[model samples]
Target: MKFHMLHRVYLLAGVSYFATAPDVLADPVSLLATAIQGFLLSSTAIAATATGAIATIAANAIVIGGLAAVSLLGGRRGGAIKPSDAKSTFEAADSSVIEGIGRVRVGGMKAFGNTDGSTRWRLVARLQGPIDAIEAYYVGGREVVVDPDGSVTSPPWPKRSGGSWMKIEDKLGTGSETAWSALVTAFPSLWTSAHRVRGIAQSLVTYYNPGLTSGTYLKLYQAGVPDTEWLARASKIYDPRTGLTAWSDNGILACAHVLRRDPAFGFDGFDWDLIAASANKADVLVATKTGTEKRSRVSGMWAWESERGATMQQLMDSAGVVLRMTDAGKIWFDLIDDVPTSEIDFDPIDIVEYSWKSGPEAVERPNICRLEYYSPERNYDMAEIDLSGIAWARVQDEIDRYGPKYLDIKLPFCPSASQAQRIARRMFALSRADSGVMRTNMVGLAAWGRYYGQITEPDTGDIELVSLAAPEIDDEAGLVDIPFAIWPTLSAWNPAVDEADAPDEVPELGYTSDIPQPNAPTAMVQVVYPDTSREFRIGFSLTGTYDLSEANYRTYTGALPNGWTAMTEGTNFAYVAGDLEGVTVDCRVRIFNGEDGSPFSEILNGIVAIDNTAPTMPVASSGGIDAGTLNVSVHGTSLNMVAIRMRKRIYNDILGWGDWFDVVTYAGRPMQDLNFSDSAASQEVQWLLQCLTSNGTEGPGLVYHYTPPAP
Candidate 1:
């Protein structure tokens, strides 16, 4: 069973129940409180109390595998010992680095024989500092404090007779009893009894923190000991490995020399595969080429530039590494991958042109189109249409006649009740045509829209009746209301297929319904050029002609034309000018199923330039030269206008080109709030001003610079 299932079973089964005898009944209040505590404890895995009492268990109680307790040890305490009092007055030790204003002292390492039968190592660090210093020890032992009379107070430990020392396990060395013997295990042939003596002497420094141990260990391994007496005491340590011992000293140096400096430079962060594939080159040109200036700079890397304006070719003749800053602001580091046997060079402009030409290839393909069909009554009414059938017979016929990619079709008028069936029939015909060579994806079905709020038919049922009614839905019970519908919810959805052999995973279909749901009253749509807002309208009169001015309630106050009625009013559609005012007006229309009041078709797939706001120019209100500084005027509306870019330019030879500044940018906020003022005196602002004011020094001559503020 699953873990959760087992837990549930245990909870239900472990709960005990008891019945009270007639003579003695349990206390109701106490029992109820106990029950609540029991439930909480069992469900939450926490210890709980009923009347504010605690519970105790055996020493071996299994409280669960993952519980831990906080240590009673608190924060660091105290003051340091002065360096002047290091000798007689304080307990003195050699090489112990101590600190403190008061005379609190701590002893360094002390060697001792391993009297206990636990391990072969023995070393103890006595605590001579204040009482709080005991908390810093890895393994705490007996603590002793000396009074003014030199009397001692010894603190007892739970276990005594044995002191703690970090044990070093040995498996591959001779004379293993001594520390020096173990240190030389890396090179067995060089070991001797004298070397074991040195290991003992060096062990004191080795058994400390990493920084102290690393520095001392490398010195001992490389230079042996500094004193001749110490060297003479352990001269047997000398071996052929002594000179090459640097490989084991530092990680970075070891890896760089032993690995990368080899014949095959094994650097990690480079593209090794590409380097290996290039026939005659040790390094491949992996940088992405962008912009002419960067390419020119990279090509002239080996050349020198003089303060007198001498060009690269005029100063140098050999190749070298060059760094070029690309127009797109990428730093390209060019290295000497291979040297040419003969003299080789190219003009900067020529190199720039070559770099530009070595980019990716562009391809051209035929255009493709997509279409959708919707019905009116049933939520889902379309049936599978034979793709080879008459779906786009008329459209195809027209296409074949005029030999054009675009075509349209008009269907015979049908009543709202049978609209679903008619649409399904047309969908099947189009599907049938799709299966053939003529791709029918471009065609779309537009369910005829209704005027007013109700759809009608003539008495004979042979002629369709159209009426103009109120735009308000409540007033359209007897009038015409446009309705839309589609079929096979999942049929229109296409799943992306995996290029490899992996099976495609099915995704859950998010909320979508055929039932009528309320939609926003004022919805927007967009359309492309030639289809202006004023020229677009949806209506039905058994003829293709319809006037939009006669359809809107406000514009058609006199009366709706022929079979139309008012449904609702307001700015449903506006011209390009409306879009310029930070508004989006779509020219697409929606068809609704009047009965359910739900959308039954696509989102019209309108094609309007969503970015309609024109680019704006920046107006400087005040920021150009106040108190020897530039206090210019600047004020702008629609500053984020997509089409425009704002920039400032200045010239001042006193400061270099490195000092220029721009406005601050934040989401939907004024740039002035982040303005730079001369009085501010910030290092960054000052440097930027200096750079901007300077001309012909690392900066182009007085050209306007545009920089978008950081997000």
Candidate 2:
């Protein structure tokens, strides 16, 4: 519910891209194939550009929006994608599934799987969606090319009529999904016209039950798949210019797609035509890559499972794309390149009311930017490049003047270091320019600009490029307030020209600033040394943030007012023994940047701190059956984590165990949400059973790795 305020210049409440989101293991190129995580901010707001037909309510209202610093770069944070479960059919139905973007290979969770007597079985697995198409499907970890007739074509299967083989079917998961023909034919009572899995990309396999032996007799069904993998071209984007939906890693197209599908934004419709035009414009403004063929200035893979606004912001910021709504309540997309013309050139004296900020405060603006990216060659792990010393960027002189610390930029989708370097340079350049924001409330509506325009400074009279502008309506005041942000030029970002920048005279201070010391350490806390060890005595870690300047860090601790002495030191981050000799009550940390040291920052005000680790493995198994209902329990003990939720399912001898189901949630005494759904069983039914987490996401191993004592 809280919003992140970027320094003093602007504050983001609802619907801000620079907003802070939840701790999640977001996708890194190949997505959930790896548990790599990154952070995005959170907030509750109306749709970004598609506020739909309703722009204003009744009387007095605030249309929350405007251009703010896109908080793109920072250190990676915590999170988890939905765990890949082999028995997903038995999983909770309400749990939000992982939806993907770009090219990805992820496991599927079954929504439903059933059988017809002893001969046939059907498994419907829903992968993250609404996806574009499946490029390949794997069974038993091997690729199988499925023919259109639903027969196994490439892997070669018996063309037997008595259900001796398997056939595969796929649905792109649109809003309107037709029920499977085979399922409807075999189980007409259960799979009727109403049995549609809409908005979920699903793959269904109709084959001879894998469980049957030559006479694979006794077993009724097999719940376990040898292995299932789906590799596909995820989320196709619609190009307004081309009027076509195709496979593209275009960040703008990606943003457009998610916004359209995610109804949480509360928009009746969108201006797709406008978005398409802007995307076309963005494509021409290229950032050069050494050995790659890239057509757009910004394009990258994204597999985010977070807040809708925050996700959209990632696509927009990564490509320098901007979204704005005009006073007429129409949405417009603007690319941050060169401005060819002004919608309305404004001079301060003519405006009714105005607030002009030249840019961010001196201390807040960054002189150097360090871009971290996922490299394909590095197996999608993170890598970094610096954006200083480039002639077109902030340069060494600027660094000497302002570079006390470097900004952390993450391009989770940019796979090339060279491309990352180019984007990082532009970001640093944009940050350094006088990013003036003009908040003027004018009486006449026509005075406002539709897109990028020009603003004449009150004192200097110099023209600037308007980067963004969002118009606000104040019906009571009878005035339209449009706040616009601008750069100090009329030229677009040119990679070729900027790459050739090499200043003749360099400052003696070079890249190092003259500041006496570095900033105090940040994200300082205690941690468990060997993760999952549960040994709290090993760590009081310091995540020393100023990587560009600091050489190392020093820690001192002592009881309340007693004397403080050096405890230890670390180059970038440090983890030291807790419950140690001198460590007590107060923990003080300072950074030494080779030249000088920073002021000590006090942390852990007596209360000991420990880093958040994975939830403990399910331990202490206990199960019993009462009145035909099976009850089983497992517990994991850890100081850093708490069990956020719990679920239960029933075990099947043949089909294995079904997915875990959550307790019904409603509202009661205080009328709170998430109250239990059902109090008792409706009829002679499926018995209840309980289970838990999978690999990597919850533990170093299977969290609920348990078999209840034989009943």
Candidate 3:
């Protein structure tokens, strides 16, 4: 007789269910509903039948000494089972328990017996209504009832080394080593039953504190066992050579041990087979991807240790995968870059309401420009991978404008900088992609069904989905589809356009007195004679004004001094000759504004004193100091109209020449003799004089040196 080979190459090893025959026998029926109902109702009968068939197959294999190859049939195929059917089956089973209880309305109860053949037995039960207390009793021994607030009325258990049973005020407080030891010691039946003791403690703690984590439960459970023994027991369950168990209860203890022992074990390779094997050995289901896409091998080690400890979910995140559990308690893995395989469309007709939001807060840019990892064994640092080339400009621009937004991840497991950089790049890319999140809302379930799946808006050609709500639900329908909240894909978010053609506003026109002439409060105005058709070149200071090319011309208008005239040529204004000494003239200028000339500036009044000639130098008469007094005479052609200034120096035979004395002056009064009282004891003295015209013009100086009487 032909028989199906039970062993599947893809199935993980050490699965005992398929040791004899095929794990799942082919059901010879097409109607799924009937098959499901029959299977559920007569599961025991089916198991017995399969056992007998397996025995027959085993006998035949012994005789033949070789197993024959048979076509493999995929396990049960159909749409997901309806939740109502499963719920009804569960309710029916619960009803059977209720019926067995008969008239005694036991609120809740649990019993435990020693598997190690001890005569001791333990039972914990909650009394109905008025009693309002949970009681724990040993067979043929004393019973203790505890109030909801952990107030115990004389516990039957004795105190342990670290803690006391009588002192436990709450379920959460029972996680201490002494408390756990007290519970096990008080009830000897739990001495050899680790799983039972853990379950009972977890139930109690969860009853008191619903927020207690599975990790916390494992920690509390392991507190009673020695580290060596715990490791040995955990290895037996999570080594893969042994059978994998459910991830809860004792299995959680095994997982915690392995994680706490070697946190970087998962990052050893890029192969999913190894990762899945490790997860399976730990009684965790880390789903594998079935595709031809190239996989990345991580060479570095990733290590983490915290007093609060870490969850398996955080481990999955470190490995760059999202952890999701199915309804059957199986695990699923989704890559960070995995896009939705299907799209859902929600048109305006199907949507009852909608909302959307986008702003600067949602914008994300690359933060990490490089990645570095250290290797202690190598005694030297690994080569640095240059991430500056990847989106360098964008990352730099963000840093330049908003300071450095760097994310430096410490990955000790990374054997090389290249691999660490790859991980960093992946994180950077994901962050950048998530930065511009466009959250939107719509009504109704007429869209794709899956968390993180894509949804297309027919009205605006936008694709969105509720990405924040994962594992629990992926689509708007799961959230009742009323005002479905979703986020737009990074590629679908349109950035604002940059308007480059718009010009900046022009500044107002103004001027200042740039070049001030002597005795002139305004800018210098060059006077020219028109005898040879000469023009004066007057330069003016201007600001808040455009370049010459940008402006048409400068216009000049002023009150001329008889022979002077002003005219606008180009940027410069031409002025005819003007012998206008002591004549004040008012002048103003306006610049062309493309369409029309600007308003004339405020009037600038300046006296026209076109005297460019310097005053004649003063002459100093030669003289020698005779009685601590030196006298000198200075003369000039324009001495009456100019002030005389003089400086004197004294020279001694030993001290050389003394510094020039302070300048002395005579106001426009031409002095025949200039006198200075010499206080210095020097052998020689020198005097220098200069003349300044009334217009403040200074002439060259005349120098005279003479010997002074020795003191």
- Backbone clashes in model 3: 13
Q: What lDDT is reached at residue 675 by model 1?
A: 34
lDDT of each: 0.21, 0.44, 0.32
Best by lDDT: 2
Query: Which portions of model 3 miss their true places by more than 4 Å?
Result: 1-314, 338-353, 359-366, 369-386, 392-394, 412-419, 434-450, 464-711
The worst-scoring run of ten residues by lDDT in candidate 1 lies at 296-305
Tens digits of per-residue lDDT for model 1 on 233-319?
Answer: 001110122332211111112112211211212243223232222211212222221111111111100000011011111111111
Give the winner by TM-score: 2
Query: What 10-residue stretch in candidate 2 is worst by lDDT?
Result: 666-675
Structural similarity to truth (TM-score) of each candidate: 0.14, 0.46, 0.26
Best first by lDDT, ranked: 2, 3, 1
Across 519-562, the per-residue lDDT of candidate 2 in tens digits comes to 33343344332232221221233344442221122233221122
lDDT for 41 (candidate 1): 11
For model 2 the local lDDT of residue 446 reads 50
